[model samples]
Target: MTLRWLLTGRVQGVGFRPFVYRLAREHGIHGWVRNRSGQVEILGQGRTDRLDRFERALTDAAPPTAAPHIAEREVLAWQQLEDFRIETSQAGDRPWIQVPPDHFACPDCLAEVRDPTDRRYRYPFNNCTQCGPRYTLIRALPYDRPNTTLSGFVMCPACATEYRDPGDRRFHAEPIACPDCGPWLSYRPDTAPAPAAEGEAAVEAAAAALRAGEILAVKGIGGYHLMCAADNTDAIERLRARKPRPHKPLAVLFPDEVSLLRREVNCSEAELACLRSAQRPILLLPRTPAPSLPESLAPGLGELGVMLPCSPLHALLLQAAGGPLVATSGNLSGEPVLTDNAEADARLSDVVDGFLHHNRPIQRPADDSVLRPIAGAVRPLRLGRGSAPLELELETGVPEPLLAVGAHMKNTLALAWDRRLIVSPHIGDMGSRRSLEVFRQLVEDFQALHGVRATRLLCDAHPDYTTHRWARESGLPVTPVFHHHAHASALCGEHGIDEPCLIFTWDGTGYGADGGLWGGEALYGRPGHWRHLARLRPFRLPGGDRAGREPWRAAAALCWENGLDYTPPVTEPSLLRAAWQRGLNSPATSAAGRLFDAAASLIGLLQTASYEGQGPMLLEQAAAGCAGEALVLPLLTEAPPWQLDWTPLLAHLRDGRLPVAQRAADFHASLAGAIRDTARRTAADHAFTRVGLTGGVFQNRLLTELAQSRLQAAGFEVLLCRQLPCNDAGISAGQVYEHLGGQRGED
Candidate 1:
């Protein structure tokens, strides 16, 4: 008898080969196991009964992460003469395998780290085939040690022995290492070895302070994070005060299942399942009035971002604290998440009690990814950790190699090669010198490694943006990609939906094709083809950039633009009146995000935003309780490109008398409703089935759900972005979509 098997998806790097070797030897089956580029394949020959047992064990008792498929057909047995000898990893000649996302800690490795008797006991960097780092540490493909950050560390004799042993837990585990040989921890300032007693003590003290109502900044695998007990009202308030993160919901880390139920409110069985999944994202569950926690943890938000223990050290701290902790990106408001320990130590010194950190270097700064199990299964709210540096499926026919320079904010660069879209890790706003350097590095690295030559460059139409400026100077033919088009195209790529649908691109700032700041938009669009169909009624952005910080300026502008009776009260709302009375504000701007900001301000909620999208985010939070339509945004035929005018809609906001929450809800409902009606009309005219929604505004859960529901109800199979973000972080993907879906064809 003879047998063979095929493996796929993250099967490489994990110790599948050794397990197969041992299982084959034990069952007295003769076989050879080796890796193919993207998969593992095995061939075995033995007696029927023994092969059957071997096959069962391969699937049942294999490494927890190894997923294998067996194939058997009649073939002559290559009868074994003696014991099984380990085979070398073979090259996988085939080309279609995707590089897997870095794996989170596995249970077995965690068990060993916790077990005092285990050789890897207390090993902070403990990893095996079943689990460890993946996307964060990997630098190149074919997943060999030489291609990863681990390339520098050579395995010790003990680790090497286990690495090659058929019976050892780490056999064939590429990142396999013990404390003796793997990466070690050290402190930065001292440079001398900081023993656990001396080094980790400060971390313990910080945790203690957190438990006692103090915030601490802790450095993790990817970047720095601000931590404090979620249950401690003082700690939450302190973190908020220090960071100035007032309204946006802070992400919390739960110890286990018990704490998950205890804190967050609406936990459906599906959400719980996803929470426990290996992805380990910050799950968005409904908020609960929990005992022991402060309501201010999530501010005005209806739901919270929560995650279970991802690292062994995180587990220990949570256990010591005895509850959930507020874990948010460690950065001062607009800047990127800090990856350098020194930066965190210097900047967050006063903000936190002390730094709970180690010396293991972070190659890139990736933020904590947020996710929600909406419309079935899990979808990414923010694509990071376990999900970034994504490679898109490209059409191989593109005539020229193009570099899609993403937006100026939440920047990510895309290099398209022979239909493969290689996206860089999230680069923060490129306006800063540091972010600009990172962007340049990403372009160079991708071009060098992927062997892509820049024949043409594409960028946002924004002239002043660093991305656009760089693309212009790149000496490549530059095509200016419109902001809303890229936004819509990103959602189109996610679902591969190619036809025209209604696109609602509402964000803080985007250069409209009409030579104005266009955030509020409703367009009939596809990946490559989009026509401006409608937009929010135009108004001058009061104080220009100041409108973002103070939503009230736009709030007052909304009142003053259309005919309204008395001036707003001269109290807290007076700021808007003053901005209006003074000629400091603009009178002709059309931005959807500003509309949201204004709405939030109108309710006396988020008068000022601590961060980007903060005002609108709080508005969504406040509107959670307010559903059902209270007002309808009227459609008027006013401008070219846009078939409908928003002037009538502003008229309603000026006169409608509804409660703040109800007004907010009606605003969202009408926007989605209008989009649905417009999309129906657009699709009928365009004669297409696919409807794709993208952009920052689509990040709104309420708006997303409403638009999806209405579109489906209208006999359209609507596609929503799940894998990539609808926000600017995903704009690079959209840019590639435009490049690929462009008339030149091919990726």
Candidate 2:
């Protein structure tokens, strides 16, 4: 009998073809296995029983890395052949197969690095088919060594032997290399005779630099990372100063599980599993009562971003140092992570003590992904490194390939082809030159890698956005989607819900249809046809852009709207008051985030924000200890943009006798109540049954849970973000969904 099989789902660059070849040889079948786009194609001829067993084993007992193996088999003409073998990969113009993202170092590679007797002992670039860089190294299709960064390093005779041997773990590994033939590391600022070192010596030198309370720029799988001992206050403070990032938490890479446990970082089984998984992202875990790290590391935040070593080099560095190290993106503030060695030396020379760079080139730069456990599931904050180029199966198809250029902040790109949506890794903010360059490269690379040309480009409606300008200039047909609408579309697309749903989109700011900044919108409809049903009442943002930096400005705006004669604690409050009164540079905005900031500032919990969401974070922290019913607030029904007036809530907050903690909790409850009331009223008016909560404001766990429970009690199915974030980072996905979900076409 003859059989032809097509296998999909993480089959490429994951040792699937080699596994198939081994299985064929074991069964004495004559067949060949090769990668076709994102899938594995196999043709085998043998006894009927043997073919059946091969089919069963292919799906059941494939390699550990070849996951979600979906197989389809067809009977074919029996072809007589002497032996089974692996065939050359067939390239296509469209991305129809799944490309496995970069994975953590496998156990075998780690063992080889730890074993002193092994030839690869302490080797920084030690990797195999089961693990190591895949997405970051691959420059083009076929996923062969010639198409990857490893093309520069020819394999040694011993490594060649392992590559050819199907039974070996490194069989057909694209990145197979050793100390004698692979890329070597070098120290920057060329001062000493032994500036460049190979194998164990290079690893030790980098580790020694970390031990001496100095920050080192270490080249990692996706990009460069700044490393320093987590316990060293001077090093942490210095790193913060160099980056000019004051309050945002830094991720800590612990040497081992014991070291992590000793720090008393709270972790559930699921979180620990994610930390140890192949996609080793920085897991944001709760901090213990007495956290071991310096307060400056994660000041004002309750959770600590922690991760285990994802690469053999990271493991070796942490092992040699014998302590936790602060691992942050190797870049200045608001810029993309540095991947090029020359760029690192040029940009990070003064910031880092020394550079630990390797000769192996990096095709693209990706930062470490950040994730948090919420309601017993992992949620992505920044999708990069091991979790990027994320593929989401779309229930609907598009007319042609589509590109969705995301928002200005937390920028990411997305591509829609056939019934799949591929969201690119997080590309940071689009404001910086480096970040814009990275975004352009990522878009072009995605096109080339997948062999798909985007005929249509979807962008945020904001006319001033860099991504929007890029789309307009691309020569492709452009579709401008509203910012919050994209957020709603992303969640709807993920759940495969094509029907109209109630979307409560809350965030800081989005370009609204009324020529004003809008957030905290309650819309009712589907992707392409959604219309805003109601929104928070517009209030003047005193000093315009300065309102985000100073929460007191938002407080002043709220106070002015409510006719309160109160002076806010701010620099030149009178100037801000004049701006609000004269409408000079004070833009009217209906934003839930501004409301949170106003409430926080009113209670004196937070007046200034060092980071993007700091005020809301502190407000949530203060509310953590208070337990009470939601305070009553007026839900005014005038028209179009209905008002959820904060007058009653502000009156309660004005009482100085009440504890700030209680006021914070009451404020959260009141806002949640307002959201629930608006959602319920909109759903009843539209006769909708499902409600989707999206946008950055939903990142607040307290508000999410509160709104979700209330909506459920009010008899509506709730759709909350699971795989993708609720922030602007997820806008690309929603954009793609909005672009394609409404269209019906054939490939």
Candidate 3:
């Protein structure tokens, strides 16, 4: 008897063919197996028992990350079979395709890189089928050598031999290259060390600059990174002073074990695993500060984000330069990450002391992903690293492929095909022309690479948002997803839940569908759909965004919301009075962010924020230990669409019975209670059970933890955003999810 089989699911890049060959040989099958598109097809002539054993072994004993192997069996017509072997195929195109993303360097490649005797030793571009470059270098799909950067440099005979051998790790590894054949590295700085040639000499000059306490633009696998020694106090301070990042934690990249001792912190098994993953994200670790590090790197922050070297260049630089280095994103705050070399040179001339950067084209820009451990698995704070290119797999699917332009701030676009969602790297605010270009390019790159043709687009409900503006100009069918609802919706879709769940979202600002600014809010709903259950009461955003920079205006707005008067609310001589002149500049907003700024000023927190979210973080730290007082919170709405009015809470602050910490704690409790009560009322009316929480506000540990507890206690299942961020960084996923789901009028 003869048989044919088709196997699918994560079959590419993974060692599917080699494993299959071994299984077929053991079972005495006579035919061939080969990959066509993403599916692997097999033709074998053998007894039914042998065929079954071969199939079972292939599926069950697959490699580490191999997903379930889906197979189809067919009774073949009479055919004479030769020896069973793996072969190549040309029919790789499928009308409906789900392409897998590129992956990290595999173990075999790593061994070759470290082995001094190996031809590829110390090759920065060393990669094989289980690892290395994917989408960034790919110009097209089916992802073969002819279609990649490897096309420029043909593989050496020795390497080509392994690539052609299905039994070897390099088999079909499209990116395989030896040092003699692959891309070369050359150094270019303003002042070059004497005789800057190729290889080790170029690396030595770059190391010299680092050891001298100078900032250098060092290029690597993904893109350029602004590097400076972590332990050099003066150098670290210089970077901080120039960058103007007063309190946000700087991500540290350790080159070797010797330097790990300098920044190593109190970490659990989960934390360690996250740091060591292929994505190699900056893991937030708690420690008593590195003795070698100065206080300037992260002023007044509780933790630091750290990682180890995953690239050969970074390793060599560190080995030469000597110790821990600050590997911050190569961009100014509120701007897109530096991608082009010319762009980096033009913008970073003053910030960087010198250049250790080389010329290796970065096809797609990706920032280092950030993660933190919550339950056993790591919760991605910012999903980048080895996680982009591939789409975020969904549980509840959409009807058509959709393109979602995420929030205006921390901009990232989402491209969805079927249930697969691919989110772009963090693109900063879309207000700038440069950032917008990066955003648009990211969208085009993802669609072209994945063959995802979007039929509809999803945009935030906020009409005035930059992202919304782009969506309108996109010339594609778009669905307007309310800012807060999208936040919760993304969370629901990420964690794989269907029913209504309590969603607690607290962020700086979002345009509520009610024509108000919303930040601090709690709601009960599911992914694609949500109801406005409760929110912070209306307050003025004095001078609009001007108030965000100067928190005193927000503090004054808090008093105004409570029916009080304060022309100057604060004692700062620099206070701009026109900002508080009612309609002269002020606009009423229900933004939770305004509330944080207001509370921070009231509780005597940081006078002003150098960057976004700085003031709020300080306020939360001060309000941490206090067991806050209970306050009378009125309903913004009488019933049904029950809203917890901020009037009573403001009056409590006015009464002055509670200290600032107690008042903040009480404010959180009031917000939690309001969400809990309203969700119960809505659940009773609609008979809904699942609730999803999304928004930058949920990033507040205290607020989310408390809100989930209160709602869970009330018999309402609460779903918190995990796979995606609660912040605007993860907004694209929600926008894509909704547009894909029939939420959009047109496909």
Candidate 4:
């Protein structure tokens, strides 16, 4: 019997072809295996039983990191072939395969790197087929070395021998190279007249600088990272000053030692597993009560964003530095991470004391992926590095190629064609010209890489957003997706909830269907046919977008709306009140995020936020370990579109006698109760039992857990984002999913 199969889902760059070749030989099959487009195609000529076993093993015994599925199978005419062999990859037209995210160094590769006698000993670029650069280095499809940035480095004799050996781990490894032929590292200190160092000497000098409390811009698998000793307050303060990032938490890369990691942060088994996973994303874990690490790493927050070394270069540097290092993205505030070496040297020279870069050029930038253990799962917050080019299977097919330009903040782009959806990594906030340029380039690069020119585009409904404007000017048919609707749709799509459901799409701000700013919204029904059933009672945001930075504005607005006589901390409160009364520069919003800020400010937690989500973070922190009864938040259900009134809740938050922590805890409880009541009312009316919690506000662990617990206790099937984020980073995927759900009469 003869059979042909097309396997997809991470079939390329993960030793899939070699594994298939070995399986064919083991089963006494005589044919060939090759990569076509982004998939693996195999032809087998063998006994029927043997072929069946081979097909079963194709998925069952595939590479540990590969998620292979037989996308196509067919009985073929008998072929005369002597032995199974690997064939050259074919760059076919329709690429429908998952681009493998960059992987952490496998244990075997790490062992070889650490071994003193091994050829790749202390080699910063050591990687095998099962581990290493995949998406970050690849320049085009078929994932062959010639299509990657690594094509410049010719393999040495030993490496070539391993590459040709089908039984070897390095077989067909696209980025395979050794010290004799691989890319080398170079370090240039900031001080003039100091000569640059190369190879091991460069690594040593960079490590020495880090130990001496100097920040170094070190290149990694994805992009450049500004790294410094975690314990060095001077270095941390210097980086903060240079980057001008005052309070946004910095991620720290710890040595690959669990014991050392546990000394500073409390890690559960799942968090530890996530930290050591092949993806090696930065995991937000709780800090020890008395952490030895400096507080400046994550000031005022009880948790720290920590990650294990994801690449050999980082592993070697950690070993050399002898401690954890603060490894933040190499960029100025509100800009994309730097990928080009010359650009990094030019833009980040003022931020770092030296440059530790290599000759291997990065095709694009992928910042570090971030995950937080929330509501009993490690949910993705920022999809990047080892977690992006996130591909998802669609429940329904998208007939035409579609591009979804995500929201302005925490931006990401998505491309959907056939039954697959590919979401780009977190493209930083589109607030700067450089960031917008990167966003535009990423849109083109994604389309080019997939060989799919999108016939239609999806973007946020807001006319002023950079993504929306870009989409409007792209000359493609544009479909405007409401921001909150996209968030709700993304959550439902990820969970595969096709039934009518009630979703609470809460965030800081989003352009609403009714032209008002929405954040606390209860959207009923499924994607493409949702109805705005309920919302938080409207409150005016004085100074519009500026209210996001000034928590006092939200507090004053809440106080004024509730008719409370609380004095605000602002110098010109009367002017703000007059603006609100006259409706000048005051946009009425129902955003749950602003309510959190209002509560935090009312309790005297934060008056002005240095970074986005600072007030909410402090509020969540204050609520930690405290349990308060749910305050009364009346559900006004007299009308078709109900309202969640916060009149009673505000009075409790304004009580000066109550502990701030208790007030914070009660605020969260009241919101959760409001969610439960609203879900119950909506479900009772519509007979929909499933509920979804989505949007950036749901990224708050405390609120998500509380709401999820309440909804589940009320006997509702709750859906939360698992593979994708609940934040705007997942908006592109949501936009694609919303379009695929059905036509909504727009576009």
* True-structure RMSD for candidate 3: 3.6
Model 3, 456-535: lDDT tens per residue? 87888889888888889888887888777777767777776656566766677787777777776666556556666666
Listed in order, each prediction's TM-score against the native is 0.85, 0.96, 0.89, 0.98
Measured with C-alpha atoms, the lDDT of residue 484 in candidate 4 is 87
Q: Across residues 1-747, which tens digit of lDDT does each residue of candidate 4 receive?
A: 999998878888898888888889898998999999988888899899999999999999999989998989999877687799999888666576578899998999999999999989999998888989888898998888999999999889999999999899888988998889999999889764443898988899899999999999998988989999999998999999999888889999999788889988999887898899999999999999888999999888999999999899998899899999999998877688998888988898788889998999998889999999989999999999999999888887788989999999989999998888899988899999999989988988988887788999999999999999988988889999999889989998888877688999999999999999999999988877788999999899888999899998899888888677756666877776887889999899999999988988988899999899999999999999999689868889888568999988777887899999999999999899999999887877797888999988999999999999999999998899999999999999999888777663423
Give the Cα error of residue 315 in candidate 2, in Å.
0.7
TM-score: model 3 vs. ground truth:
0.89
Model 4 misplacement above 4 A: 193-195, 744-747
Find the 10 residues in a row with the least total lDDT in model 2: 188-197
Better of 3 and 4 by lDDT: 4
lDDT of 1 by residue, 621-698 (tens): 667877758344555655444433444445444444756667667777877787777666666456666666667777
What is the Å distance of residue 159 in model 4 from its true position? 1.8
Query: How many residue pairs clash in all the candidates, one count each?
Result: 17, 1, 23, 0
In Å, residue 193's CA in model 2 sits off its true spot by: 9.6
Q: Which candidate model has the greater lDDT, 2 or 3?
A: 2
Ranked by lDDT, top first: 4, 2, 1, 3
Better of 1 and 4 by TM-score: 4
Tally clashing residue pairs in candidate 4. Answer: 0
